[model samples]
Structures are given as C-alpha cells and as structure tokens.
Target chain A: MSDIRFQCIKVEQLDDIHVVRFADDKVMDPARIEQLGGELQRLSDSSESPKVIINFSDVKFFSSAAINKLIVLEKRVRAKGGRMRLTNLRPEVRDLFGFTQLDSLFSIHDQQSDAVVELTTK
Target chain B: MPADADWIWKIDQEIPSRAEVACGLIRDFVEKLEDAGWNEALVFAIHMALEESIMNAIKHGNANDESKLVRIVAGFTASLFQATVTDEGEGFNPADVADPTLDENLEITSGRGVMLIRQFMDDVEYSQGGRKILMRKHRG
Candidate 1:
C-alpha cells in the first residue's frame, strides 16, 4: 500500500468555459478518478455557470469509477446552474461512452477549443 | 516472463486506502505485457479492465473489508488477454442495476462500472453468483 500517485488536473478559463485537463497520459485508475472528483467538486460548488469542457486528450483509458465521478460532477454542475460537456475523447473512449450510452447524456465534441466555442455560444 | 506462466495474486486488503496498491501491481503486469505482443491499445484495455474489476472486487464485493481476500489471476495469449477477480462477499444480481443510459438514471453513479466493463472488454461474464467476474479482450 505504499505506492500512490496523483495525476495533476489543471483547470484553465477559456472565456466563460472552464477547460479541465488531466496531467496523466492515461487516467483509468480509481485513485486518479477520486482526485479529479475533488477538483470537480470544488469547481462545481464555486462557479455559478461553469461551462466546463473536460479535456481528455491525454487520457487514453478510464474505468467505470471515472464515469461515476463524471456523473456526480454533472449532477453537481446542474445543481449550480452550470452547463458541462466533454471533448477530445480518444476513439476508444468514445466507443466506451457509446456502449454505455453515456454519450447521449453529455454533449461531446471533437476538440477542446471547439467545445469552448460551442459552450460560450450556447 | 514467458506467455506460459499465469500471474496470480491475493488481495487481502480494503479499498480506497489500498486501491493504489492493487493498481500498481496491475500496472507492472501491463508493463510486462509488451513482451507478450500486447500493444499500447491492448495494454490500455487490459489495464482499465483489471482496475475496474479489482475495484469492484474489493469495494462492492468485499464491502471494503480488509479481512476478506480478493483472488486475481491474469494471463495473455498471442491474440487474447484474460483476467478474473473473485471476492469473498455476497454478490448482487447484474440485472438489478438500471441501464445508465436511461434518461432517469443518467445521474446515477453505480451502473457505470458494469457498463464500462462490458464496453472495454471483448467478453464479460459473471459467475459464482456474481462474486467473480471474468473478462477478455482480443487484440486488433
């Protein structure tokens, strides 16, 4: 139980949208999911209309725990009157979302900048 | 490590506090997977599947009790990879979990894992009254 590594998630403001990027090249581990959940909680609580785009360009794989965290985060965001979406998902990630049918629940786009554009426009 | 040997481990620990312990072991296993012809994509799938399965074993199966043991076995062939995780706890019926894609259940957090397990792996089956999960992925 000695080995533990936290992937740093950086949030940047792109106009009105918040672009949250994960430092991990591939974030499928539950520990990293919990860490991202913490960050999402803080942001969800603080922002009034956080048009968020979770950048997953660096994340090649993720587990169900990660999706659970996103679901919780989406709930919190909606509770706060904010809109959220996902962007830059790898092909595998997109397929996973499609299989789970979660892709229907959240708005997904191809790129982060494009998501920001749409978020600000909407 | 040749492809003939099967890797096995007994997880006698709780989750969240020691989930990383399980994850680290799996990561090292995947690192060795390259020698077995598992590419980056296949390794990614195997890693994610193992993580989700092990977590479910400890968290949901054992109820995060350190006293229970979660037995894990992993192996890979030339074009296929498989792993199984069996836990020491009462299991639930998979049918009991609602479809996560449904509009009403979109916000629910529990079903995502089961869904992801099915999506990432080529085949997923539950046995031992749902206490153990066997998953396999085929290399492209």
Candidate 2:
C-alpha cells in the first residue's frame, strides 16, 4: 500500500444534484481511474440519478487513461438523462484537453458554483 | 558531488503497480535535483519525459500484462539528467505511429504519448527493438 494520499472523492448534494469532487494530485493512474469509474457507476445505479459536477481543482496532471475514464463516465451519465460538468481546471491540465481537442467535448467551468449551476440548468 | 546524486533504481515489470512505483522514484530524483537549484524548465522537461517513458513501458511494452518487467535507470550530473525505460515485451516500430495532428487522425485516442515525449525532452531516442527509450534534459 503506497502512502500517496489522494482525497479521491467528495459527494455533496446541492438540491437535486450530486457534486463529486475528485481532488488528487495524480488522477491519471490506471488503478485510481478504474476505481473512480466503479464509484461513478455505483452512484449512477442508485434510484436518485442526480446531475454530477466534477471538481478538478486540485488535479495538476492529466493522463489519456484518466480522460478515457471520464469519457465513459460522461456517456453513462448522459444515458441516464443526466449530465457531468467539470470545474477548476489548472492550465496544464486544461492544455491536455485542448491537445486532444476534447475541450469542446466536455462542459468545463472555471468555478465550482458555475459548473453546479450549469449542471442543474440542463 | 552531492550525496545520493547518482540514485538508480531497477524493478521487474511483473508488478501490477510498476508505473506508480516508477513515477514515485523519478519524483524523488527530480525533487533532489530541484533542491540542488536545478533549473525549473529542466525539472519540468525531465518530469514529462519520465512520465511518457514509463507510460509507454506500462501500456505498450508490457501491454498491461502485469506479467512482464519494465526496468528504469536514472542518472544526473551537474549539467544533465538522463533516464531510460526498458520493457520485456516485444518492441514495436516507433516509425509506424501516425501524426496525431493530421486531419483524419485528429479524433484518435492514442499516439499522443510519443509526441509529447519528443516535444518535452531535449533529446529522445529508442533502442533494442524499440523496447527501450533514453531521454535527457539539460539544466539551463
């Protein structure tokens, strides 16, 4: 068990939405990404399928594996008629999305409140 | 020469957590260099190089088999930092990778690792049937 401590998940409720904040320095590892996917799937399986707001405030690195997992999460959320919004992207992390041209594919915001509002509006 | 300046670590590729373990080792190396007042650009470059090389070993070389071994070697001198990653799997041709910026390949999900590695490193080279990569960055 490595001592790399990551605040991996934070589930908060704002009205009907579920804000799942993944605060971590290294969110790109395959194991951690898969664990996140499993958690998201479990959350989506519940009777209350609330809109999701993903906070990326603390994430500084982005890996293709992590992006793939998020794409899967997005598809799952949309299949349930809910949406996922990302927030608080650091510049370097944001550049990864831009490099893949996925910046347009995801709904991103500079602020958590903004992302929460956008998710609820949809 | 500072103590622990020539840190080198080698591990088998069969470990399921090799990537994380390798990254941790490189991070410690970079931190030590940074503490020695190494240039920030050099540190960032080396960090990206280490990441891409390790990822290639994990994803491409080992094919995520968890049965193969990926060996990493890292060294630093007063002027330059160099690292090498070698995998146990059969090597693939690096020339076969297509340009991700091409119009038809724009939507592809893969092929970004090598490109990023080349972009960030001062020098990048492959060897031994494409199973090994040597990357270096110089302090400015």
For candidate 2, what is the DockQ-based docking class? Answer: incorrect
A7-100 per-residue lDDT for model 2 (tens digits): 4566777877777777566665667777776776766665245487878876656566667667777777778887778888876676666666
**Model 1, C-alpha of A74: deviation from truth (Å):** 1.8
Q: Could you tell me how far off, in angstroms, the CA of residue B73 lies in candidate 2 after the best superposition? A: 2.3
The C-alpha stretches of model 2 lying farther than 4 A from their native spots are: A1-7, A47-50, B1-17, B33-45, B64-67, B76-80, B98-111, B138-140
Q: State the weakest 10-residue window (summed lDDT) of model 2 chain B.
A: B8-17
Clashing pairs in 2: B13-B68, B13-B69, B13-B70
Q: Which regions of candidate 1 deviate over 4 angstroms?
A: A1-7, B1-17, B35-37
What are the candidates' C-alpha RMSDs? 5.3, 5.7
lDDT of each: 0.75, 0.70
- Please give the distance, in angstroms, between residue B128's alpha carbon in candidate 2 and its true position after superposition: 2.7
Q: Best candidate per lDDT, number?
A: 1
lDDT of candidate 1 over B9-89, digit per residue (tens): 222333332576677777777777866667776777777788878888888888888777788877776666777788888
Q: Per-residue lDDT tens digits of candidate 2, residues B23-60?
A: 67666766776777776556555666777778888888
